[model samples]
Target chain A: MAKRSFLIPGVDKRLLIKDSLKAMPDFTRRRFIAGGASLGALTLLTGCDVVDSSSAETLLAQVSKFNDAVQAFIFNPDALAPTFPESAITKPFPFNAYYDLDDAPDIDGKDWKLEVRGLVDNKKSWTLDELYKLPQVNQITRHICVEGWSAIGSWTGTPLRDFLKLIGADTRAKYVWFQCADKDGYNSPLDMRSALHPQTQMTFKYASEILPRAYGFPMKIRVPTKLGFKNPKYVVSMEVTNDYKGGYWEDQGYNSFSGS
Target chain B: MASLTVTDEQVGVTPAKVIQPVWVRVMHWINALAMILMILSGWQIYNASPLFGFRFPREYALGGWLGGGLLWHFAAMWLLMINGLAYLVTGFATGRFRKKLLPITPSGVLHDVRAALTFKLGHDDLTVYNYVQRLLYAGIIVVGVLIVLSGLGMWKPVQLYYLVMLFGDYPTARYVHFFCMAAICAFLVIHVLLALLVPKSLRAMIIGR
Candidate 1:
């Protein structure tokens, strides 16, 4: 049913737009001003009337893609994010995520399996104990947040590059996408180069202790070379793929390849 | 470069010199607009995680929100870098920097500072820059370059670790970037006041006389 048209049958479209504009004082002032700029640029660039907020957002979204390319271009696979000494580690490293500390997924290691999918030859899902049996390396590195805060924490895990190699993942795949256990199904795509970075890890422990609930129990992808969000937490599965599947934040305008 | 000068026939006397060329005028306005957008959006970004306790009044900010602020900031970043680079390259290529901002001695700068404080500094020849003006312009240019470099260092700290090291660290680079922005803001206020104080110079920039 045409519910909106039923209230005011055969309403003049132009008058409807005009009256709506009059009602939206804040939108007319703030969004219109900002939206008008991108509208102008978009009109020039695309040669069409993309006359709404979504279209303007589209223009900005394109810039994020451009940033992804630039980030990838500038990214040095061999250049490591600097490691800190034990003394330099921030005391009580801050727990951060889209959700509150209480809401972190209650994961049982016995039931939780690290599912390997996509191009990896080894599709076996490893239990927490099995995954922990692999070689572990530790590094004290800064976790830089998108909001401009940073903290140093020591993480211990199997190097993702070595892990991927062991799993017989296709090295030429463009992305290693992670699926998390968060309620929102939080996920992220890690670029192949960054995925293969020496420091990238399938982290199992933080500060010599089993990963806490606040810090993603069972697993988290530790990507020191990237912003915090890129390091997916409570990671349940990882797919080695050539496709470009956007992440929760990346889909919402955060740069895809937000590598430092 | 071909100069845009009024011939003696047009003025019916001596040919007039072009104080600001067309390219310089275009680049100046573009840089000014770009810097304004950058600073305003940057303030919004700063408010996300403030260095100081106080926030910039919201009305002065450009973007409506953090995401919007970032979009505006990143968009203007390209404009500022490209235009600033062109300005510097063109300035050096034409010896404009040397001609307009040279001979800045400690005594000369001191003399101009005294003259400026006493309101005795003359703006008779709009073509010529006083020692104070010269220093301010040169200082701002350096600040502009540093801000871009520091921004790059922050943007890719891991990739550009060498550059970050030169500035001490990531946090220091951020502080340097903020201070450079403050310097630019200060220069803008003084530059605008001086322009309004001497309208002919402003007209020279606009019309390129």
Candidate 2:
């Protein structure tokens, strides 16, 4: 049999909605109960939005609390940034906003010095050449950006531990501070767990070549486990510290614990 | 009463009720959530490269985690697809699509268009809805389907070869997905405003009499 399609003219479909209700003459007790159950389900779904919003807030709070616990434990006077192997490199990293680095020192390679100070037994400033004379470390690792991008690159630099030992890190210092030449004046606060990860370290090679100066020029701090913003570039000084501190992006609304 | 003009001949109008059944309402709210999640996660993916100047920090995610964003989007997409299809099928089988939701006639469309434009021109007790609401609802349904189809085209280019061919290429499919999202966002803005303008409209959908 050929089906005749239902067609209505000049009346909005919504206007005729009541007709559907009228057709069900047996709006019995069971139907009412079923309808109620469905309505309850509808209400529950409506509350999902609010539930999702609160759960997100709770997660953020927990992350912050975890960072706080790490901050409370104190032991070593100085810590070193971790080193990585050269085979695990990533590519195509982007420079973050350097809103804090505009007015800093020019850091000419000739006079560049990495001042190691504060809470250390021996506060000393080592020239770039002197610092480079130490054991060099290299690693290939992903530079995950806080802005949602990832790049793997080979980085070459002296082991931060080598620098710490040279300056005679005391038992009181627990964190290392990086003072960058880019005027960013960015300081990173790291827990011992991340500060000494084997895959974490400073680097100067990218894509199997000398690292571009545009990345950080003379030298940069590389913490592979954290977001790229935490890896300060054009680093001028490495301060050993027992006191807690934060970096450029951290102050401008970034996670201090920024780890995997 | 007749002298006082309370007669049916004097007014010649009757109110027609609009009922958004439990199934339709549940499906609607779920669809809304899924779309919102898809958009939020999409923004996360887009932030990887700011095609425009806008940027959202990777740490800040709608789902509070970058990985969670992707998971929720995919999960919600499946739910929306299943529920949407169910709505369409049940709507048809129960004859509700034809009797209450379908607009298969030219005059029906014309009346909707006219009523949509001239808000106050209809009789005071007219139960018929103007065309604008139907048009918007129909648009949401159509665009929703397109977005899902285009999404599949991107999700599996080789498997969904026919769907991808419809859009010509993968990038073209992405464009369709993006524009459909824009349409949904636009509709939402207008829908909310209209709801505010006519307060009883939203209540009617939620607590139908």
Candidate 3:
């Protein structure tokens, strides 16, 4: 039998012993030991030992993965984020991004083409007008930012699920990655569940007006259920793939599935 | 020890009763630690995007960044919820909730408030809880439950739509969560101060009298 040392050093052993009278079940202990072993394996899998910061990053990433699994398991596809009336729309919706508004890329809408790649059957690129011709839907939903503030905005666009169906996308793929035209290569990946959400749209208009450059001019993926960063803006290309392609902020330690 | 004796003399009493059971003492300390960690880390998470105009000072918040803060918050959240549930169940099973924590009357509360305001409040009995103590404890427990529900609403707004709707909306739920946290913090301040002022009461909770 392996010696188990779950308690941290310098903790009050008397209290712990007293508390452990309400013992956990045997299966829970076994599962926890297995989890701990996998955590060690994860550290090794990242090709780093405990001495390096990479090990810590790997552990954080593993925890994030666990979080993603828990969230996905609990997610209800049919459920929707609460919608608000137009009267509840926040006026002067705040513009937020890694770059300043003035530095937002000014792309020629007519010249832009949305390149499609990976497991989709139809690999034809899409023009903005071509996308606008798809069945459109409007929703007034709250845009929650990780930074703590939220604003309600009216958005209109084709649902990404509908678009994926049009492109004959392999809907069972694990990830849907987006490549954005924003500076510093701002991009994000979405889980298949979120990608298929009815509210997940390839947004063209905001607040009944064509999306301003500050809000992703050509197009934005409006995912109301996810935190703001997960909804990548100015998207130029999309790939449906089984491979794990880490995102810009995700590589920096933000959880890949940052659902609020 | 000497101060205790002097205080006993001043109050004309002797402390010998077992005021807190071992379970109560254990649960109390665990809850205290869990709440402290949760508040500190919650502040760190809140600083990521502050509700108000300004952010909490970075030094006061726990967990270095948004990621670290979330980790701490989630871990402590489980600790708090589970331990809190155990405490409640054990408290009821042992009749402690009925004998010590319950039966708070509005008039008794008013009397205790007046006594406190008039500086006539007594701490002669370490084995029994005063009306104010009972009321505050009951109020904090309710607030703790609200905090947990509101937290769930914020964490899974879609799955827990009814909970979110109870608070009006998602942003409003966040605000309510913050407000409940502040209320618990305020209760903690008063609780700690009262414990210090009546040192024997603190000792009773620690060593079970």
Q: State which candidate has the highest lDDT.
A: 1
**Model 2 chain B poorest 10 in a row by lDDT:** B1-10
Q: Model 3 segments beyond 4 Å from truth? A: A1-64, B1-16, B117-119
Q: If both were scored by DockQ, which would come out higher, candidate 2 or candidate 3?
A: 3
User: All models: lDDT?
Assistant: 0.83, 0.60, 0.82
TM-score of chain B of 2: 0.76
Give the range of the ten consecutive residues with the poorest summed lDDT in model 1 chain B. Answer: B1-10
In lDDT terms, how accurate is model 3? 0.82
Instruction: Report the lDDT tens digits of candidate 1 across residue range B90-137.
Output: 999999999999978999999999999999999888789999999998
Docking class of 2: incorrect
What is residue B23's positional error in candidate 1, in angstroms? 2.5
lDDT of 1 by residue, A43-87 (tens): 342342435656666666676667667766766567889988899
After superposing candidate 1 on the true structure, give the runs of residues whose Cα lies further than 4 Å from its correct spot.
A1-56, B1-15
Q: Interface Cα RMSD per model, in Å?
A: 17.8, 17.0, 10.6
Off by over 4 Å in 2: A1-106, A165-174, A204-211, B1-48, B51-209
TM-score of candidate 1 to 2 decimals: 0.83
Error of 1 at A98 (Å): 2.5
